[model samples]
Target: MNITFPHLGNTYIAAKVLFEGLGVDYTIPPLSSKKTLEIGCLYSPDDVCLPFKIMIGNYVESIQRGADTVLITGSCGPCRFGEYCELQKKILLSLDKDIKFIVIDEPAKIGIREFLNRLSMVAKDSKLSKAKKIKALSMAVKTINLIDNIEKECRFFAGFEKNKGEFARLLKTVKLEAIEAKGAEKTLKVLEEHYEKLKKIEIDNFKNPIKIGIIGEIYTIIDPLSNMYIEDILMNLGVSTRRTLYPSWWVKNTVLSGLKINFSKIYKESKEYLGLCIGGHARECIGEAILNYKHGFDGLIQIFPVGCMPEIVSKAILPDIERRYGIPILSLVVDEMTGEAGYYTRVEAFLDLIEGRKKLCI
Candidate 1:
């Protein structure tokens, strides 16, 4: 089967490594863009969350390019993500797309046997042996972790770079070039070279620039198009930024969650505000805001799609966190109708507010 999946930040990189390592024929959906969102909106129900619409667009685009199977991770939730696969399947069928879907749920939720059965379906078409397949999975995880580290380094150092925009430029170039590499080993090598390049980029360590932490619903914060590339804007504005959630973090967390293990600092900091997993990354959002403040970040920016239930709850609690911790926060809600001018204006004002606070501190 020629398989496809939705874009979630650098996940396409790991997925490419996995599929190629398995020797399976696969298609990477075109990167999410305005046209992709428009196509999704045209076919999706008006009230569905933004991620669903974007994913629908990805599937439609992939199908047109000859993909017949879609792979998606499943969630059991008080949030709406759990219902997406069922709804999306019907939506595609109505459009006469007729694509097969494989939803990978947690083994604990769907049972280990069922999870493996679904996994085998993907590996079944591969020419690789069982041992090789296992090795490929391990490689993919390492690749994802490396990419995330590269991103974290880029975003955090953009403000301190001696050559403006060097980190941002290198980051874009690395991702584009890595995708063209023909095998997992080459891809890993490409990333390693890029990581080294990032480390060697000149930076002014003494420069004190605005430092902001981004926290919000997982999909919107991770996907550039969905959130209007907020992190890119912050980088271009010479703001150092940090985000606690990334695809690698999600992967690591999911694996350890069954053992009731979590990031202890996050759990402790957010305990006073939100004590339970309200589905989505709401708990992470609250905990990260506190964590970043403790780390001395000047401010925080929380972005989520309009009508995102989990983030809506986090947004309500954020003002109190800000008051208690003395950290300023700006919350941006985006959807198909989000206007660039208004969004940028608010970000600029937030920066000004933080700068003013800095001056007062001095």
Candidate 2:
């Protein structure tokens, strides 16, 4: 089966590496864009959250490009994300698109045997031996972690860079070039060279730029197109930003959480506010806000698409966190109709507020 999946930041890079290393055919849908969103909205119900719509767009685009199977992860939480696969399948079928869906869900929900059965659909397509298949999976994880690290480094160093735009330029260049590498091994090599390069980027030691922690729905925070590249915007404004959620973190949490052995720190921090995993990343979002505040971030920006139930709950609880910690927090809700100008205005205003607060403290 020719496989395709939704784009989640640097996830496409790792997925490409994994599928190719397995000797399976796959199609990388063009990056998420206005056209993708438009297609998604056209098919999705009006009330579904933005992510579902954008994902639909990705699948449609991939289908047109000759993908017959759509590979997606599933969650059995109270969050709407769990429902995405079922709805997407129906939508595709309604549109007369004959697509196969392989949803990789938790073993508990789908049963361990069923989980393996679902995974085998893709795994069995590979010509490689079982040992090599396992190796390929490991390489894909490493690739994701390395790319996430590079992005984190770039965002944190952007504020202190000796030359304006240097960090951003290097980050953009690395991502673009890494994806073009011939194979998983070459991609890893490219990332390693750039990881060292990122360390050596010139930074002014004394510049204490505004630092903000991004906390919100996992998909919105990680995917640039979903949030209108908010992290890039923060970097351009010379602000250092940190986000705790990444594909690597998600993978780890998903695998181990079923064993009740995941997110010790997040659980500890969020206990006072949201102790339960009420679906989505609401608990994590609440925990992250407090964690960033304790770590002395200037402020926090909480972003999620409109109609996200878990984030809506977190939004209600965040003001209390802001008051308790005395840190400013801005909640930005986005959807297909979000205007770029208004979004940028609010973002800039939030930055200004943080800067003003910093000046007052000084």
The lDDT, on a scale of 0 to 1, for candidate 1 is 0.92
- For residues 1-362, what per-residue lDDT tens digits would candidate 1 score against the true structure? 89999999999999999999999989999999999999999999998889999999999999999999989998897899988999999998887656788999888889989999999999889887899999999999999999999999999999999999899999999999889998999999999999999889999989999999999989999999988888999999999999979999989888989667775688788898999989988988999999998899999999998888999999999999989888999999988888999988999999999999999993
TM-scores, each model vs. reference: 0.98, 0.98
Output the lDDT of residue 287, model 1.
Answer: 93
TM-score result, candidate 2: 0.98
lDDT (0-100) at residue 221 of candidate 2? 90
Query: Which one is best on lDDT?
Result: 1
Off by over 4 Å in 1: none
* Lowest summed lDDT window (length 10), candidate 2: 255-264
> In model 1, how large is the Cα lDDT of residue 71?
95
The TM-score of candidate 1 is 0.98
